[model samples]
Every structure is written in structure tokens, then in C-alpha cells.
Target: MEEIWFAINDIPMDVLSRLPVKTLLGLKCVSKDWHRLISERSFIRHQLKRAEPVSGFFFQERFQWCDDDIKAISYIPVKMEGSEVQHSVFNFLPESVVLSAVSNGLICCRSCFPSPQPVIYVCNPLNKEWVTFPWSTPDKRSSLGLAFDPFKDPIDKSTDFKVVTIHQTASDMEVEDEDKDSYLTFDIYSSKTRTWHRSREMCHCHHSLFKNKGIFVGGALYWLTDGDQILMFDVQNELSWLVTVPIPLVQFDSIPEMCIGESEGKLHYVLISEGGLHVWVLEDYLDFTWELKYSISLDEMEKENTEFLCNIQQRVESRMAVDTTPWMDPLAFKDSLLFMRVAARIYLFNFETRKLEELCTLSMLGPNSIISPIVLPYSMSLIPLG
Candidate 1:
């Protein structure tokens, strides 16, 4: 039976690469040659080229009560065709987890709370696999970012990634007049060498809070600086630069409801203001050019927005008043949809249809629990972190 099946199932490499990672792993046990074929490095590269499309989003949800805490991580698909669905939770992550960053398919997490020392972890939410890196020394409060581009380095074909901790750049520093030349330093951990290295000092107001606003594209990570410019980091070279920010509309709020995300391999800047939302795409990184995409009026969105706010208000205790501000945050950018997050609900806005649908909700959290949610665009991969 094995011989007959092998003869009939000699599939092409492209076809084999398109199979889900779970299926590919299972098929490895079918036969010896099958196992060898799947294990080849060249084969894995092809698999990444034809990687399974992103099916949904992975989020870190915190459910906190007066005395108890539950850190739940879950994945929610963009579409809901079933009767009712819930998030796929993974219990491997540590309690009181803070999801720092996500790139490619790996999620960067850190354990927070109570302890003076915190440990960082990288995980693939798809396969529910995780790797904990060594923290050579105890760390104070710092922001971290992850960078991964398997095909970035032309000289080396091997897949690797790095975790960057902007440990030295503090938002508020009391620099004495005599020490103005001293700057903040960066610490990086390379997966290739499986070690950490402290690099050169950066002379800028890093305001590492930019860490939360990071978006990776074309071998680099870009973060919004305090509205005046953008902080760009070259992950491979471990260097940083500043680029002037393109303010799409002058009427944009002081701190507009905005987000930076990538779509179709290009960086897009979006902000909501004066009942209108607009988008700007970074045309050329070197030239620092930006082209406007669209400025949409909220006239069509009022109904959907109202419904969404009402939905959440109905669930929350009447005593817990909802924010009366008319606003929604752009969480992510996809081909056909925009992820708009408000309160504890995430809604998918269809660009073509101009309609809003609740993508996912943090309902399982206790009635008394204070919820904090972080939703990120996720695409699962088969790459090994070892």
C-alpha cells in the first residue's frame, strides 16, 4: 500500500509547499524519502515563498480582576462563517504576559509584574511553539521590537531574526549640562548567534514609546516620532535614522487617532479627523515621498459606528460609562479591510462596501475584569526558531 501510494502521490514541489504546516509535518512520517524531502533547507525556502495566506489575527488579551489575573492569547479569523466561534487560546505563555511586538509569524512576549527581573520570549502563535532567550542581566523597564526577513541578506540564504531592546532611550532624562554628548544605547539579540550584544549609542530623543507604534517593512522597522518625524531602524545593521513625517491633513488632531501599517509591501499612514479618515502611502523611502490615497467622510460610517458602540455599551455594566468621544483606532491594514478597534471590540471595515462588521470581541473576559487588548496582523509560517 505504501509503494502504491508513493507512486501516485509524487506531487510537485510547489504543490507540496502550499499544504498547511500541520499537514506537511504529518506527512513527514509517511515514508523515509518523504521525511528527507520536507527536511531540506531549499524546500523550506520554497515553502515560505508559497506560505499559507494569513487567515486571521493574533491578539493578547488581559483579563484582570481585583485579586486575579488571566492573560489570554487568542487568534480570530477575519471572517465568521460558523454558527459561533471563540478565540484559539494557547496556555504556553507565562502569566502576566506583555506582547511586545510581532513580525513575520513570530510574537515577542515578556513576563511582567511583581518580579524585579523579567524574561522575554518569542513564540509562533500558529504552531503554539515558543522559544525563551537568555537575559544575561536584569533589565529595567524598556521597550522591545522584533525584526525578521528571511530573504533580506543576499549573501546568506539561511533564515534568521533578531529581537531589539531600546533599553537606554528614556522619554524623560535629566541630562546634566556637562553630559550632553552621552546618548542612549541599543541591545540586540541575534537568532543566528543565539546571543545578545550591546551596540553604539544613539544620539536622539528615541522616545522608545515608538516601540508600540512600530511597523516592519522592506528589511526595516519604522516608528512614528512625536509627530515631527519618523524613527527608522535598520534591523540588520543595528542603526537608526529620522525621517520627516508626512502630515496628510493639517487639521489632524493634536494626537490624531492614527496608526502606521504595511499593505502590498508599502507603508501607509492613516489618521481620523473631523469626521473624515485619510491615508498616505510612503512612495519612496530614500526620497521620503508620500502620495495621498483617499480621504473618506464618516457620513456613511455613522450608522455602523453607532451600532458598534451600542453593542459594547449594552454588555458593559450601565454604571461603567462608555467614552462618548466619536472615534475609532486603525489597528491594521490589509488588502481589502481596515481593522478598527474601539473599547473591547475589533471591527473589520470593508473598503469597497463601506460597511463595518464586528471582527472579534473580548467577551469571555469576566464581567468585573478590566480588559486590555492588542490585535496585530499575523501570517503563520513554518520557519524554525532553533
Candidate 2:
């Protein structure tokens, strides 16, 4: 029987990698040899490279507290069930763990309570597997980012990942005049080496960490700065540098929100304004040149005659001149679907047709249970942990 299963599992590596991650996970119980083979790092990498489209969106639905918003802050996955129905998976993630970013199929999460600084973890929700970073003193002072290669090996369950931490002076630490602005260091953790190393003092140490999450595209981690500059960390070479993001057309007051992202296997920037959401691709990384690719008109979205968010114009009008404040941070962009959040409501916008439709309403989760939900891009992969 074991020999029969072995014969069934033995196949061309590339051919096996082409199979869906769910199919591969199902094959693991067929035999011990199959389990070992399916768990190979190279195999996982290959599978991720050929993995299918994103399976769902992972967002946190927070519940209000009696005092100062206890914020039952939770990580939840609202998975797509066919075209219209969505199912949520909660309690699978660690409690009070704030997920900051997702790369490939793994999400980067940090501890939110009990400690002044958070402990970081890289997790795979599909398999309920996670790996925690070794606690270090510097982790208390820095913001962390996760970067991985999802395209080359999205299928394999064992692709190595890197975590980059930017440490500034600890808020609680008493600082002398000399120590002020003297504490810029980056702590990098390599899964391959299973170790952490610190870099020399970075130039821009005093600037506070950006409130927005970091995006990893083309093997580099990107973070926005208050001074309109971007911090780029090369994951492959483990080097840090600053780059000026291409300036967008001034469309509104308060400087319309924008962020860097990855689309179609290339690095791109997304600008959200009253005019529309403009996409600019970084054509030349060497010269820092950009090319405007697509400009989506928000006005067209208001014209769609759909039941979902049909009265968005009315909702926007009630907020005086400020209008509505979207949750910011798009979940994922693919095949014309732009997933984003407006407060507690998640919507799917089609850039081609300019049709905006609500995907899911957190009010269904319970009244006021959806405090400060964050939209995160989710790609299901066959990731396994030992």
C-alpha cells in the first residue's frame, strides 16, 4: 500500500508544483514520502510561483470596550464562497495579534497588548502555522516589515522569509541630550540563517514610524516618510536606502492619501483623490522614473445603479465638506477588482466599468463589533511549519 502511494506521488517536480495548494495539502496524507516531498522548500517556492489568485481578504473586526475602547482587536478572514457569499474565519489567529502586512500567503503580525513593544510573528492562516521572532530589546523600539518571494515559489510550504525592523529611540526610555536623534538602527532577521543582525545607524532616525503598513514589491520593502520620501529596504542584499516617490497631481486639500504597492509583478504607486485613483508604475528603478498607467474615475462609481452602497453619494454628503474617510489600504488589486474599505464597509470597485459594489458589511458581524477594521491582501498558499 505504501509503495502504491509512493508510486502515485512520484511525478515531475514542475508538474507537481503546477497543482493547486489545496490539492497538494490533500496529497500529504497519502504517504510519508509524499509528506516530506510536499514540504520541501524548493517545492513550496515553485508552488507559490504558480499559485492561483487571492482566495480572500483578511481584516481585523474590532469590538468596542467600556473604557477607552478595549478593542477586542482581532484578525479575521472573510473568505469568498463562490461569487456572492462570504464566510469568515475568526479565532484561528492569535488573540489581540495585530496583523500589519501580508506577503505571498504569510501574514506579518505583532503582539498588541501586555507589552509596550510588540512581538512579531509570520503566520499562514490556511494551515494555522506560525513562527515567532526571537525576542530582542530593539524590537520594542522599531517597526517591522515582512518580505518574501511569492511569485517564484508560492506553492511550496517552506519558503524562507525575511523580517526588517527599523528601530528608533524607545518612547519610555529616558533620553539624554546626546542620545536624542542618535538611535537609528535596522535589525534584520533571516529565516535561512535563523539569526538576527543589526545595521549601522540610519540617517533619518528621528522621524516617527509611518502609520501605514509597508509594502514589499520586487524584493524590496517600502515605507513612507513624513518628509515625502520613501524608505526602501532591499531584502535580497539586506541594504537600506531612501528614494523620492514620484509626485502626483495635486487633486485636493489635506494631500490625498496614497501609498506604494505591487501590481502585475511590478512596483507601482496608487494615489486616491477626488478626481480618481491614479496608478503609476515605476518604470525605471535606476533613474527613479515613473509612468502613469491607469486613471480610475471615482465619479463613475457613483453612477452605478446597484443596491450595494447605492446611497454612497448621500453618505458622503452628510459629512460636511470633509466627506467620508475610507479605511485606507486596499486589500488586493487583480482582474479589475479593487478591494477597499469605507469605515466598516468593504467594497469591490471595477476600474474598467467604474462600478462600485459593496462586498461585505461588518454590521452583519454584530452592532459596533467592527471598530477600526483594516483591509489586508490575502493569497492562500500551501505553507507548512515543523
Q: All candidates' TM-scores?
A: 0.76, 0.74
After superposition, candidate 1 runs with Cα above 4 Å error: 1-10, 19-41, 61-70, 83-88, 93-96, 136-140, 153-159, 168-184, 201-203, 206-212, 248-250, 253-255, 302-326, 334-336, 352-355, 362-372
Model 2 C-alpha lDDT per residue in residues 1-386, reported as the tens digit of each score? 75465366545566778887778889889778768877787777667667366555655543344322232433323343445433334345555566667787788877764556556778887788888776465343356788877554343445578888776654445665545654446777877778888765364444454534567877887765544556777767766666666773333443355655666767666666655577777776667788887785554554563555344433433433323344343445543456665667766666667766666666644465334344566767766654
Any residue pairs clashing in model 1, and if so which? none
Write candidate 1's Cα lDDT for 1-386 as tens digits.
75466457646566788887667889889888877877676677677766455566656544433422235555667666673334444565655566677777778877754445667788776556678876655454456778877666321355567888765444445754543443445688887799998877474653334413457777777776444566667777777776665764344433345667777777877765544567778888777888877667655456556776543322222212223322355766655467766666667776667778886554643332123345567776666554
lDDT of 1 at 1: 75
Please give the distance, in angstroms, between residue 319's alpha carbon in candidate 2 and its true position after superposition: 7.9
TM-score of 1: 0.76
Clashing pairs in 2: 44-156, 45-153, 47-154, 47-155, 48-153, 48-154, 48-155, 49-151, 49-154
Q: How does residue 306 of candidate 2 score in lDDT?
A: 50
Candidate 2, residue 140: Cα displacement in angstroms equals 6.2
